[model samples]
Target: MAQSTRRRFLLAGAAAAGALVVGWGALPPRQRLNTAVPLALDGGAVALNGWVALAADNTVTVVVPRAEMGQGVHTALPMLVAEELDMPLARVRIAAAPPDKIYANIAAIRDALPFHPDDTGNTQAFARWTLAKVARELGISLTGGSTSVKDAWLPMREAGAAARGMLVAAAARAWGVAPDGIRTADGELFHDASGRRATYGSFAAAAASENPGDAILKEPHAFRLIGRAVPRRDARTRVDGTARFGIDARPEGMVYAALRMAPALGATIAGTNAAGVLRLPGVLSVIDISNAFSWRLAGHDGAPAGVAVVARTFWQAKTAAEAHAIRWDAGPHAELSSDGIHDDLRAALDGTEHHVYFAQGDVADAQAHGRTIDAEYSAPFLAHAAMEPVNCTAQVADGKVRLWLSTQAPSIAIGIAAAVAGVDREQVELHEHLLGGGFGRRLEGDMVAQAVAIARECRGLPVQMIWTREQDLRHDAYRPAAVARLAATLDAAGTIKSWDFIGAGGALTDHFLRRNLGLPGAGPDKTTVEGAYDMQYAIPHQRIAHAAVASAVPLGNWRSVGHSFNAFFKESFIDEVAHAAGKDPVAFRRAMLLGHPRHVAVLDAAVRAAGTPPAGRAHGVALHHSFGAIVAQVAEVSVHDGAIRVHRVVCAIDCGLAVNPGHVAQQMESAVAFGLTAALEGAITVAGGAVQQSNFGDYPVLRMGQVPHVDTVIVLSGEPPEGVGEPGVPPVAPAVANAVFRLTGQRLRSLPLRLA
Candidate 1:
């Protein structure tokens, strides 16, 4: 059976079984407004559901459930509420929401369903609906996948609307007038007939008594604060250095700890000189925590075991930890190398077994007649390389665990911490801080778990564990390396008649589910073949497959997940097919996107904005759709002394309606710089089962001078808002690679696109 058909059948079977237990599974999501504990109100603050709090001073606070990782989510999420409540954006304050089922990332999971963006058939729609309900029940509160804005679009607005209606109703009751007669603007409710005006704060007590029944959201045209660019709410704090990142956490009695992990991916300590390490100045004790977490027992992989030195200061702890001598058991993977992993992927591709992700029409028959073009592309494993190294602070007292850290998934972090601390989830208190960078590094709970284990030996004192930059990179859950073989056939008319893309790599989703949820990952993973299978191009005969190869390397989601590398594969191959057919790259893509107006619009916008490349530079274009957003990028490139330099990148995005156009543009620019770093120099190599590149010297990032001047054009869209954070990243590498091909006539099929 075709993959799509098989997926539908499985979903149907699961839905049938779920309905028997979950009462038909068609119920709406669980209530998002009510919390077990009410919002901690003070100074005449009125709690309105789980999201909004109104104070007697007429201040509005919107609870942002997502992390503020420089994406301006602290500002953009509040805009959703301010627009509905008729409040000025500048007057709104932001608060991080406590971990709850209400803040679960239903959109992320629903978006992860193995269906093409254009596949809106009944089966896919039903599967999405069912998955969303299940996601709500699971309540995995996460803040990755560019899901913040898209997930909050409806709920936050409704919270504001409900509060607005309640305030209006409260005023109507006070004045003996109909609720419909009250108008709200700038935090004031007005009644023209009676000439009565009052602040929403004045009616806070009464509004709490009034019921807002099915409050209506404002139409797009009625939006006041949304669709307008406002300064980020946390900008001032960040600028003045008042913003507290995880590293900035300083508790009253906190000590410092430095970890010296095993020198290999799955190694453990055999022996250590604890007494000598403890003799170092300011060194409190050496705690051997190698047995704290068992990857096999936890169904996890590549969680490094280590010994930590607790001391008076971070530097002292680091000095002591590094000086300690230890013998390690490197295990079976001691001889693993990057070359070995590459060969493993190639061997997997040679196998006959594969999971077909998407298939349409008869690709074999179509491929038999047309002119064919085949290419193989590979991208090396990459580290998240977040600016902040891994660190976490934890304290265990009175059978309770308290943590201070930056995490992408608080619910998951809490769960991991609870387990490590041997406490119940509710007994754990997580204080989330701002992240210096999370591209996806903070998503894993390993850091939190390790910190909790270290703190357990601190005798009721809080311990802040910090990893050196070398340790951070070496022990990172690297992005999975992937290899793809793509073959496409063009008809006599220079139009693609058949397209096939088969990829092989470690399946990140399986690894993630096993490590995080302990759920067995069966069936085809959408992430393994996402960017290739979900292409918006209208290929009549197409097949996309993926063969998962087992690996000991710790894998995690990167900036764009599968789209990160797959776009480089699919789009670059598309460029090859275009050239082979003697057609312009943009024209070739445009021809395939006739049925996709949003894609065509973005491509046209990017092309128009890019215009003609300056002398000595060539422009290359690529388009990709991910996270319900379509982004097209045109890169201007020049090779100077055999070094590829991206001069400028013009990006156009149709991310539904951008919640904040300015922030959207900033994200595009950030994504381009990040993607360029990977395209030009990012790679995480392994030797003897350990990461070979430890710090920036071996693993370099894109320098400021190397960053291209990015121009973003957001196509005016009326569709519901989608994500902007990751959508811009997918097309960047391919765009640059294609531009280099255009300039140098060299097809760089491998990543870090070295010029030969």
Candidate 2:
């Protein structure tokens, strides 16, 4: 058995490496090259060596792997690295990591599966297998689906701890003292007994010389910095306007470009008359950006065909572009609308035979002998709708192109820019600027290629291509709309006997994976159907299936990915089952989760924090475990003046060890606000093949006035730390919906719940 296991392990490792090679090869050749030096020292005196660097003045620098779009990962992730390094919070700085496979998220790996994480008997083995498959498929390690923090929880902490160990070893070697005798605090190593002390800066050179070996990490009980609350490292800079976002980047001799794409998806620019627009004030040039190569070569249909108006300033280009007369070949999707898409999905669900994703026991027999309940739910398409719109600035000079932008996929960006400019990837320099927000839209590198194309046409002059708020809204690759049908059976004692879920939506995984593998036909997209089919409840029988339907609108990942819509469908249906069984929502969930103490603890904490009656606020509780964390949220809501006002929210999270209590709390608060906004008024509808909502005024985000008083409670389970960024998102929608149900006695089947 042992020999067989070893052989299997070796085979798996070999396969993983092979997949990595194929995935990398599938990307544009430009992305495979590297240019930036492994080590860099900034004017802030901060050092960046690979993924981490420390300042001569004692500040620590950490390279973040994911984009920050209100999830507060910029603050939360640095906190994790700093805690493990035992550094003071004020001395830590953050930088976005370059694209590489080392940063690919493991949660997204599991998400690609047709099964749930808990359903596997050996989660570790399953994870390894899934990761190998992902490496073979995605090619580059990119961040999406809120998996950044969770995926990096271990590797990042170990990197920090290893660095700290090296510093301690260097200090011990210098002081001629036992390693145990040396006490390290902030950035200094000291020996009080011998009166010997040294700052990390003094030993950094020697420490850098010594290779970090396999050092034993500190146990959770011995950690002083991991669980404590510390203020955000970037908070002051962000508040003081010192933080430089993508829009803030300006190069010498930089000109601006504004764009207008065909309103309908899959449309192409046939021709454009730039004479009248070129005569406008500040109009420098007009360039057509059609045929810009796709950065995501995997599963991409074609280039992001569009036209660019170059001007001296953003407003000038915008005015000129608006005045320019452009003709478009509105492709097959010109007649598509939201209602039409909904009908298509409904037909697919009803008529098409879906791929069997998961099956356990005989669901037919269980349903045959028990009381059955059936329900259908739907969610509209959604936009990432980041505060800062989509934009990229590129300068191509002397056969070299430099890009400064807030992009989730820098590696892909370099490759796309290189392809467009007809240069080697190594010749392109990517200055990854801080993103105002990047749920997943930035993951697509079309804008980077567009900017590069414009810059190439302008004799290597720097060109800043800015997408106006209107364009950003109208042209985003939206989260696909979905329809779910759930059926559950209960026994005589009211226990759930069987569960079945069927989903129909556009396939995100199939598009990317099939394109990379050179597969011809459409395959089952597991992401659209996995969440509802893979319920965590201990039902005796369960079956899940999914059918992928073609859609004209471009689809991509959103904040919780499948869970954003699936959680609502599954949890809300579970609540409906509880109502059918004549039990309270909290009680029903607790009864179902008899053996899971971690999930139970969070649910209990959330309910208790919500308080009892006399407050006149009804409470609704939702518990979901995703991206390695188990989170429970209790929402208190009341209806007044024909409006549903969420008054208070209590959240309890168990994300293994609390790397930074303050950051965790902040993330939970941010999640509540973000999720609440989506639940209240976040939707992107299509009419006449064009996006209807243009900006915040039409597609409203949650404002400060609408935010509830949030109470965050962290549950420290001596387990390994999970994810902090996205686990908080899934529970918020269901919790709020449940609370609304309590207040109005009306169950909202869809999102953006209307009160009157």
> Which 10 residues in a row give candidate 2 its minimum summed lDDT?
1-10
Tell me how candidate 1 scores on lDDT.
0.87
Positional deviation of residue 717's Cα in model 2 after best superposition, in angstroms: 1.4
Give one digit per residue, the lDDT tens place, for model 1 in 237-309. Answer: 9999999999999999999999889898778788777888888899998887776555324647635788889
lDDT of 2 by residue, 210-322 (tens): 66776456777777666777666667878999988999998899999998777777787887788888899999988877666543444365335678899998899998888
Give the C-alpha miss distance for residue 381 in model 2, angstroms. 0.4
The all-Cα superposition gives candidate 2 an RMSD in Å to the true structure of 5.1
> In candidate 2, how many clashes are counted?
0
TM-score to native of every candidate shown: 0.98, 0.89
Q: Pick the candidate with the highest lDDT.
A: 1
Please identify model 2 stretches exceeding 4 Å from their true place: 1-37, 42-49, 52-60, 95-115, 120-141, 171-183, 191-193, 294-304, 511-523, 613-617
For residue 326, what is the lDDT in candidate 1?
A: 93
Alpha-carbon deviation at 277 in model 2, angstroms: 1.5
